[model samples]
Target: MQQTPSVLTDQLAVEIARLGIVGESSDIGTLHRVTELACQAVPGCAGATSIRWAIPSGDAGERPEPLASAASHPDLAEVADRQLARRRGPVFDVVEHRRAVSSDDILVETRWPEAVNDMLSRGVRCFSTTPHVRAPVLVTLTLYGVGARALARSQHAIASLLVAQGSAAMSNSLQYDSVHRTAVQLQEAVEARAIVDQAKGILMHALGCDADDAFAEMRRISQTRHVKLTALAQRIVGDQGLPEITERPDRTTD
Candidate 1:
């Protein structure tokens, strides 16, 4: 028995929701999965490709740069490559308009003759491009069909939903990476502070000086030796001795 469109949509939704779990996969992984699912979700879709484009900084006139791409089949990837290399096609048009672009038959498509020829040579007769925007990045999902007018307008909703879910997953993954880096930096800073305090205490006992005097001397030695304060502190704590410092000739008198 053939499944209804509603059933296929529900199944796709469930699959897409699984991608929302942060740290479950990287952005490339998500894009690959999305392309695979696009073929399954859209009726008559022979293959699918997902390309990620980075928005140009401070230059709206500059074209968006393609960062990565994932395709369900080699032919689909080749079609995308041709479009990107030529800098004109449904993908670029979708990005420019921030809307979906579709061609029911490439043999008669006149807007991008070169891209149309590429697609026809690859046995792709119909295609659609859908845009999904996440800040700093724009992702496009393209579905290919082997027969003319094979892709129906009804299938566009499924394609849009897949890219939307893929975008959310990517956003969560980026946020997780950012938070992990910040946590690592904070831990390193705490460790550095503890070691520096230990080094200062060692200085105070050996020099018979107050905390301020000990810190000042350590700072002077650190600056004169061109060593990082944290590195000098770690060395002092490890050896339990002050680093030798050459006194600068008193230039203040001159």
Candidate 2:
């Protein structure tokens, strides 16, 4: 029984709503859900997997590997790993181009010969990969089929929409992580400032020096002892005598 495209779209929308809620809890959980949805939504889909990599910044460092992955079957992970090892396949193509790519017949796909052989060995006759673009990252959602010509060309739109939803959820997750990191960093900064101020007050009282002088003394001690300003301040707040240093050692060795 063939399902109409509209039905597939509606199903994808419902799944997306569920994913949105799950994504709020954990990005990994959302990814796993997407894999399950991919298998359920796409016609002839025997298995599905999702992979994501952070976009490289300056120097275009070693192409970042997929940070998260989910597969319908355990064996599919092995298949994905083999392709990842080779850095080739429909998934790679989608990541590289930020577009959707598919193989209607893996045995005859010339672009990724190694992946082709691997998928064939694993009974994956066809597969499709769609790019989910999230700034600083690109995710590839893939659906695997067990028979040649399993995916109809008409299904590409549906596959892409599903991937787009997954990408959106992933982007939200990334932003959430970034926000959390920023909050942590800000809290640390605030704590460090508070400690440094307290230590400065102590120095001002002990030496009858101005705030600037107290801060300068602490800076000098920090530089000479090669200790972090926060640690130095902590020691001062603890009423420990400032350690005297005769000379600074060179520490440029990698």
Candidate 3:
């Protein structure tokens, strides 16, 4: 689950390592690199952006999961977001259904009539969403400022590999997030626990009980009152009164 790539995968590894892209913090760099590399490696792939559909992890159902975008280009991200909101673009559908999505002719997919028309209006006619091997993830390589006919002359394998690498990078990013968060939580827990131990020592001295008994007493009260251990420690240490709990803040983007 380490995001580090092997030496044999030297090509991509070299680029990622050069950018210092190890995890979610490196997402932007990863996106930019993917697009640049994809364009160079795959024919007719004017550019690519890392994009995800209907990310369950997104807060408030507002932002499009994570997309590998070249930049904070409003036109590109807006089109992608609109397609998802409209639920009518092949990119969204492919990512949502976890399938290889291609449109040799976007006009043929009747299900996305409204969305397709809108896309055509943007001067982008043909595109595809290739499923990343480490999926539930997808990459949509948009061939724009050019016609889909150009894609017909290109190598299919190269395109597939471009998407595959993008997927791997995305999955690795997620795994990095998991590990980073676990570490932060472990540190926080240890700190909170240290304080709790201090408070327990105070109680143990006051009540003449053993360490185990003191800890057990804290657990009993926390469980009975349905409060978290850290919160309890705060109250006992700072004498702060307990109040309502708010939505947990997302530390990923933060």
TM-score winner among the candidates? Answer: 1
Off by more than 4 A, model 3: 1-21, 24-29, 47-50, 54-81, 104-116, 119-122, 133-139, 191-254
Cα lDDT of model 3 by residue, 8-103, tens digit: 246754653443334534555655665555555555554344553334555544433644455223455566677656655666666556666566
For model 2, the superposed segments whose C-alpha errors exceed 4 Å read 1-12, 18-28, 59-64, 105-113, 220-227, 238-254
Q: Per-residue alpha-carbon lDDT of model 1 for 1-254, expressed as tens digits?
A: 12113336676778877866777677888889988887777888888899888888887899888888999888778888988888887788898889999999988899888888888888888889999887765789998888888888987988888888887777667777889999999999999999999988887777776787678878877998999999999988898456663333232433
lDDT of 2 by residue, 31-135 (tens): 777777777777777788888677777665456568877777777888888888877777777777677888788777788888788778778888888877767
Q: How accurate locally is residue 25 in candidate 2, as Cα lDDT from 0 to 100? A: 46
Clash pairs (backbone) in predicted model 1: none
- Candidates in order, TM-scores: namely 0.88, 0.73, 0.56
Off by over 4 Å in 1: 1-11, 245-254
Q: In model 3, what are the clashing residue pairs, if there are any?
A: 49-68, 50-67, 50-68, 51-67, 51-68
Question: After aligning candidate 3 to the native by TM-score, how far in Å is the CA of 220 from where it should be?
Answer: 11
Q: Decide which is better by lDDT, 1 or 2.
A: 1
